[model samples]
Target: MKTVTNISDLRQQVKDWRQQGLKIAFVPTMGNLHAGHISLVEEAHKHADKIVASIFVNPMQFGENEDIDSYPRTMDNDKRQLIEAGTDLLFTPTPEIIYPKGLAKQSYVEVPNVSDGYCGESRPGHFRGVATVVCKLFNLVQPDVACFGLKDYQQVQVIQTMVDDLSMPIDIVPVPTVREASGLALSSRNGYLSAEEKAIAPALQQNLQWLAQEIQYSRKTSPDHSPDFIGLAKKAAAAIDATGMKTDYIHVSHAHTLQPASEDDKELVILAAAQCGKARLIDNLQLSLA
Candidate 1:
């Protein structure tokens, strides 16, 4: 509906909304919205009286050689989807407004231990960028609650840990990963897949599915050595490699701390990353292999 690009204008509007006794819900996105993003808006609408969603293509969250320039930015399409999904206000700010002093000059937020594994290992500073921008958004909107999709499971873990550690009063609600009928996790990056890469894309999901199945079979057939966690990790890697993936990292970790699982009955997160041509993809499935 209404788009407010300036921070002061958005703040004045939200102050008015709060005076009316409306509870606010905020959803921060990097534009290029899809069904997965819409899914977050739906959850926010259900929980808060006033919904404020911001479309910011953050510069801080990107790494050297990463797709900051190539990353999708479909603002017109994104606005229509949010309005149709019942988002009340669109706070689309320029990078200058978000990081007035510039990214290099802005303060950052961090969460320990939880950021030690998974994507954190390869991307380096990626999560810090994420935490910083998210913290900025939180301070900007000051919503009673915020919604994030579980598709970015590690990100959710990081933000949840940050809120708890700092005693920030905002409630963080997480929605499950939304997928296409073919099983690929819906992402803005999916737009980068080539014709051949698109055909090969579902294998990311297939690899995670195979990891789940392998754990099941390993438990049934060889109950004596039923839960060989390391073997499951290797099998997941082999599946990704066999699928023509240029690997990033495949990890099996505890669902909470994200530390690699070493014993039985521990919840496991099977996360894998790889590139299909120039497009990078990630997918994960949580299972009880122990």
Candidate 2:
């Protein structure tokens, strides 16, 4: 597998592949590769002839007090895993290459309302950074299809909205979230957890599952009733807090619009974020009542 750090080099590689009549699939990620990331590459292979993965930790996505400094790099190890996963090309660019004018001077893209709650509420301007960098990557790779994990559920919705609104031609494919046996979603930030914190982490996933069950049961038992979702969210937050983790937010929203789920909404998604030890983790589950 070839790794290119410059846009020109990446373009040439992609051009050559296109000339050969091969379609490209792209997976954009920050380094510190894990099984979940590899699964994204694996899913990419199913959609196109070649897969190109990029590893650049976007600084714009980090909040003022967030741990951008401590975010894991793990480039050497990441390369090994990507090559093992059968990645065709890897793009590893510096920040200057990605944003030559610096973030302050660089133009950004935002999807507005879709990015305003859940993780967006907790980390202001975070999705703007994500939308901008993803737009840049989409332009750079010019892939036939791009793959993203459902692990970042809201992120998937935001990007989907961006593509639809901007009329981007590439297909956005979502792979299921890869999880540990204990149910914690696989994340690069998972490396930050201590042993004790790791044990407490799975509760995030369990509680989300519990919430899903409650929502499903409510739909069945009280067909005409609208369960007080806000009150249920508080109870869910308390359940998570009881696990010794600090809750960020736990709310139910429409699966597609990310607005508060209503009585008539057949598709709903429950999303959560919390701080466990030094790591701030997020997870969500989508459900369709009808």
Candidate 3:
């Protein structure tokens, strides 16, 4: 795969591909690739003739005390993996290239409502940084389609909402979360987990699955009654905390809006985030009441 670091060169390559009438798919990431990221590239292959993957660690997304400096960068392995995954173009832009005017001067994008709670609440200005950078990349790559992982459930919602509100023509495809055999959803942050924390990590997914089952059971057994989502969430959070991990939030929300779920909402998602050693792990399970 050819790697282009500058915006002009990247745009020229995409322009050349467009002249040939080739469709392109994009997968944007913050380096430290695992199997989960590769899965996104694999999904991109199904959507377009050429795949453009970008690795830019945006400082705008990280909060104060959220050490952007320590975030892992494994470009050698990342390049090898992208090549194997059939990525046709890799855009590795420096911070200056991405934010020429600096973040304070950079124009930003924010999708409201869906970007309001969960990770949005936990990490202030996170989605603004996300939406802004993604908008910038979308303009630079101008892919026919973009792929994102559902492990970042709220993020997908935010981007989708942004695309719709802005009326961008690109299709936003969400790939499923890739996980270890123990059921822990794969994340770049997972690398920070100590061996013991790794053992305790899958509890996040376990509790989510259990909560989903309970929600389904309640719907089936008591068709006329609300399932008490708040209570179910509390139980799941307590269970996760019992595993010695600090629960950030365990919420049952309407899958689409990421708002608190109501009994009438057929499509639901259970989203959670927790502190596991040095890593902050997030996971979700989607279910249908209908």
Candidate 4:
């Protein structure tokens, strides 16, 4: 319920909580919160004694020509939602506070290999911004556990890789993607969709689900061809295109490394990003053939 914009104030409050032997959970997000984001805070409660949610529309994570300026900022509504979701503290810092030395001079973090494909390929330098800001938040909050939504599947893997490689002491927990009755993955960006576009948007998830089922069914039947993954991806892309949305990338990859998957790979995930109307949407589903 309490909101502090300064880093020192945020840390001091956390320090007091630490003295009380309270385990902290952190959820970092941009301002425009929805059920998807609140779900993260709700999930955080099961793992820690207190939850600290941050709202900073990270400029570092956005690319040139991206919606940096127009990205929605609903702080009043976001605070209300976070408080209602049982978040203990809200850290809402300005860009200057986060990057005191200025963005150009600030140190950055990058997780190679895991961040190299999928969204990484579509938006260059995106993961570097994500890893850097997340690292900053981790250092500032020093929580015992952090919760991230699995809607950004590759992002989850990237952060997991960063934490394991850097030996950061925070446990990374991934909450499942929250969706609508219509099967659309709930996202802050969903706000950008027009009514007409909204109706068609759920097709993205539908296509991904259809592909997952096809892959699973094919493997179960012991098909000779092993289900052509590449062909399925292309067909999925074409399906999205038919819906009048532009497909960014639809890829099937090894769930852990985000690399192209082979039939022998037991764990796989299908991830896709597409633009519909003004909203840029992403969704994924994980499968285990093992």
TM-scores of the models, in the given order? 0.94, 0.98, 0.99, 0.97
For model 4, residues 14-60, the per-residue Cα lDDT tens digits are 99999999999999998799998988998999999999999998999
Which is the leading candidate under TM-score?
3
lDDT of 1 at 243: 68
* Model 1 per-residue lDDT tens digits across residues 244-280: 8777888777887788775555587877788878777
What residue pairs are clashing in model 3?
none
How does each model score on lDDT? 0.85, 0.93, 0.95, 0.92
Per-residue error for 88 in candidate 1, Å, reads 0.5
Residue clash pairs of candidate 4: none
Runs off by more than 4 Å, candidate 4: 223-225
Model 4, total clashes:
0
lDDT, candidate 2, 1-290, per-residue tens: 99999999999999999999999999999999899999999999999999999999999999998988888879999999999999999999999999999999999999989999889988999999999999999999999999999999999999999999999999999999999999999998888899999999999989888888888888899989986788888888999999999999998999999999999999999989999998999999898889
Q: Is candidate 2 or candidate 4 better by lDDT?
A: 2
Q: Worst lDDT window (10 residues) for model 2? A: 226-235
- TM-score, predicted candidate 1 vs. hidden true structure: 0.94
**Model 4: ten consecutive residues of lowest lDDT:** 219-228
| Candidate 2 deviant stretches above 4 angstroms | none
